[model samples]
Target: MSTTTTAVINLDVPGPTISRHVYGHFAEHLGRCIYGGFWVGEDSDIPNEGGIRLDVVEALRALSIPNLRWPGGCFADDYHWRDGVGPREDRPRMVNSHWGDVVEDNSFGTHEFMKLCELLGAEPYVNGNVGSGTVREMSEWVEYLTRGDDSPMASLRREHGQDEPWKVPFFGIGNEAWGCGGNMDAQHYASLARQYGTYVRNHGENQVYKIAAGANVDDYTWTETLMKALSCLGCSRTPNNFFQGLSLHYYTHTGPWEDKGDATSFTREEYYLTMKRAARIEELVRGHAAIMDCYDPERTVGLIVDEWGTWWNVEEGTNPGFLYQQNTLRDALVATVHFDVFHAFADRVAMANIAQTVNVLQAMILTDPDSGALVLTPTYHVFEMNTGHHDAQQLPVHLKGDLPTREVEGSALNLLSASASTKGDTALVSLSNLDAEGPRTVVLDLRGRAVSAFSARLLGASDIQAHNTPEVPDAVAPVLHTGIRTHALGLEVDLPAHSYVTVSLELAP
Candidate 1:
């Protein structure tokens, strides 16, 4: 039987403005995300701009990605920036122990990354190597990029090709410090965060927003201690270098991290459990944000979810270190749910990055090696459909209706997720249904605002496991949705099972 649900959108009630940075993407030095997936030799047959895949660059720019985090997850800590600069041939080769343990030729260096940011028109968020490096190394790296002054680093920059300084807005001190980044306790890491963050110089008008490594998953103690310690230290003198934002990393998994189920071969039961875990991010963000509020009531310290998205076993017969997997309809639903949660907490959550954007977990696009083919995944479709939310003011959604639930492990899981936003002359209402069966009838009330006209797009497939492949690139693309109905009271639409829909309304003139 088809289930009926309703939500009241109070357009008259204003809410927090959503930061476009919240929809940012991350590209680590892991797997095909860098080498063949995004970067190839300029002489290759594939179409590219200065060795970067042209298709990949255009595909990401279409989404209007606000920022791109670079260097590493754990890789950023071990990476020596000096080894990656200068002439490509003269650059040293290093073993990528965190990824595949393969030899990195250092072909794509600092110039290549900053160029990528320029191509995509995204702000560069570089993660400094704090775990295994000294403060001098971190400071010099900044000076090399930001200093127009004739410092040693800047002089070397002129020796290389580019003479101008590149602007770096977001700078992360470390990543996952509680585990991979030196495994220090909260107090110890807090001291390092303050000390290391102190030396990161801000040159010219480019003010660096220093983000500190935060909690892993539900480590509230880590959040509490870091906030408390930093708060006490700030009592004496307030410095912009010390932790402008606190980062949190959480990857949704079908099961435990050690045995995260296969990305492409998961059962319906496994999918339900994974959504349950993904939905838990609301609690994680809210809990951590509340702790920050205690220490920073004015919301000076922003909550940044820099590392997030689903992680699962890599494809069979592939390099395990590559972290390559297929993006399915389930991943699209997960992305929708996570975005809604971020929008719901827009007051505190300033920025977020879907981990490993191109070819890693929950990647937006996948590139095939044998055929040099590019395919946009289901998650990609979701992002494209909801691009209207960028830099838009959020409208509080007052959902008060009976929602269908799926029974999983003696629990009733809600099947619907939604968020709304307004920008310029239009409004966007995005909705998703996680139920594997039974379409949902969503009766929406856009109170206080009259809709002159409306259009919609839906991204879904018949099967939950439907995904894209190099051979079949258009497997799960967005289709024009004409299921919307306008009336005196509100608007109504049929949300298909295992689907995501976005309704763009033209406000009454």
Candidate 2:
């Protein structure tokens, strides 16, 4: 039986404006995410502009990705910026010890990344090296990327070819200093952030929003330790001036870290377990936000969830360290619910980046190694559908009726998830049905505005394991949803099991 769930959206009373950066993407130097996925080299047969793949850029451009975080997750800690500048051939090669022990040719460096960001129209968020790098090295990098020609580092950049200084809107002190970035305690890492972030200077017009590494999962103390570091009792610096945002890293997966279940081949029970884990992000965000509230009640310091997404075991036969996983219909639902939470907490949560953009964990685009053929994953479709909500005013979604729920590990799991936002005269409503075997009837009680008409798009498949392959790229793509009807309060729609639907409401003036 299709359970009916009614969600009332108060358009009259809107909350914070959802920052478009909340839908940002991450591109680390892991697996083919950089080597073959994004940077295919200027010499390659793939249609590219200045070594960056044009197809991938075109696809992501449609999604209007606001910002792109780069260079490393863990790789940032060991990455030295100088080696990647100057002549491409003269640049030294180094082993990517953190990921696959493969050698990195240093072809895609600061200039290439900046050029790529220019092509994609995304603000660049550079993660500086701190794990094994010196403060001087990181400080020089900021000068090189943002200073005027008078600065020494900027002059060096001119010698390498880029005469104009690039604007760096976002910067990270380090990545996961608790583990891969460095094995330091929270207090120790917090001190380093103050020191490192202090020198991440604003050269002329380019100002960087420095993000400090915060907690791992449920480590509220990590946030507290960092917040405590902002003690300006004796100093001239205020808490807001110390660091603009604190970072959190979380990934959803089923089973132990050593034995995460397969991405596609999962049982009904495992699927439910995976959804239950994915749903815990709301709890995690709220936990960290509550801690932030205790310190900065004015909410000046933003919570940056820089690393997040589903981390499944690598596809069979793939390198274990590469962290490659197939993106499926299940992955789409995970992205859907995550956006809902991000929208709800738009005030506190400043920015977020999915684990990767291509050829990695819960990737948006997957490229074939041999053919260079690209396939847009189901997760990509969700981002494209939700693009309308970028920088839109968030509306409160209240569930008036009994929420469709299921028992997972002795806990009630919400089967229907949703978020809504308004931009100009139209409002975008994103909905997801998490049940793997059952459909849902959802009544959207839209208040505060009269809806003249509406159109919806649905993304789903016959099987939960449905994914887009190079040969069958459109297998799991979105189609115009015809299962919707208009009503006085709002609209009623039917959502399929394990599916994601987005409604575009044309609000009457």
Which candidate achieves the best TM-score against the true structure?
2
Q: Each model's TM-score, in the order given?
A: 0.97, 0.98
lDDT by residue for model 1 over 1-509, one digit each (tens)? 66778888976665888899988999988999988877986998988888887889999999998999989899888889989888888999998888989889888878899989999999999999888989999999999999897899999988988799999999999888888888888889988988989888898877899999999988998988878756743354442347889899999887766878988788888989988888889989999998887777767788899988889889888998899988899998999999999999889999999987888988998988888888999999888887889889998776677867777767777789999998877889999888887788888888877788889899989998899987778879999998889755588889988889999988874
For candidate 2, the TM-score is 0.98
Which lDDT value does model 1 have at 34? Answer: 89
The lDDT of model 2 is 0.91
- Assess each prediction's global lDDT (C-alpha) against the native: 0.87, 0.91
Cα TM-score of candidate 1: 0.97
Residue pairs that clash (backbone atoms under 3 angstroms), model 1: none
In model 1, the worst 10-residue window by lDDT is 232-241
Minimum summed lDDT over a 10-residue window in model 2 is located at: 231-240
Give the poorly placed runs of model 2, Cα more than 4 Å off. Answer: 231-240
The residue-by-residue lDDT of candidate 2 on 220-332, one tens digit each, is 99998898787432333447575899998889999899988899999989988989998999999999998877777777789999998999999999999899899999889
